[model samples]
Target: MSLTDQLMTDMKVAMKGHDKVGLSVIRMLKSALMNKKIEVGHDLTTTEEQQVVVSQMKQQKDSLVEFQNGHRDDLVAQTKEQMAVLDKYMPQQLSESAIRQLVQQTATDIGAESKADFGKLMKAVMAKTKSQADGSVVNQIVKEVLS
Candidate 1:
């Protein structure tokens, strides 16, 4: 089934199970997905849907950092739970070592020898790893490799 259909099914199950947090998270994701579809003026392909999911996950991660700094333990715990739920929909994350390896490979492929080639290297690496690695992680790996 499509991600949207799967989400709708999960929403129904969450409702029946009396899972309030799960239901709320699923509702928000559904709304985001629908809004993204409207923005693009068509049904989302799987890649577009994955982008929407990743966007939501990024928002949660940002909020998590803010909550941590604010020392809001309750909010932090809640956000962590929501992040966990969001993660279920994302593609598997690449490990730092794997990301480093990818950066090395991309640099070799593109003949990127210096920091001046950072942009070219990043574009190539992102195209290859967009669905697997986080942007910040990839950026760090690239910096480490180039430096």
Candidate 2:
């Protein structure tokens, strides 16, 4: 089933089970997806749907960190639950070593010898990794590889 279809199914299940948190997360995701669809003025492709999920996951992670820093345990727990719900839709994340290897190999392939080639290296690596790797992790790997 498509992600949206799966989400709708899960939302119904959540409603029947009285899973308030799960229902809330699903509703939030649906809203984000609809907004993204409207923004692009078309139905989201599979890749675009994944991008929307990834973007929402990123926002949740950022909020989790902020909540932790502020010692807001309740918000932190809620954010973590939301993240868990969103995680079901995200592609498997790359490990640090995997990202490093990808950056190293791509750098060599593109003849990226120094930081001067940062942009080129990043473009190539990001193209390969797409939603599988985090941008900050890829950036660090590229920097480390180039240095």
Pick the lDDT winner.
2
lDDT of 1 by residue, 1-147 (tens): 999899989999999999888888999999999999999999999988888888899999999899999999999999999988888899777888888988998899889999999999999999988678889888888988999
TM-score of 2: 0.92
Q: After superposition, how far is residue 101 of candidate 1 from its true place, in Å?
A: 2.4
Candidate 2, residue 83: lDDT? 86
Worst 10 residues of 1 by lDDT: 84-93
TM-scores for all candidates: the values are 0.93, 0.92
- Model 2 residue runs over 4 Å out of place are none
Quantify all predictions' global Cα lDDT against the true fold. Answer: 0.90, 0.91
Q: What is the alpha-carbon lDDT of model 1 when measured against the actual structure?
A: 0.90
Candidate 1 wrongly placed segments (more than 4 Å) = none
lDDT of 1 at 127: 91
Q: How many backbone clashes does candidate 1 have?
A: 0
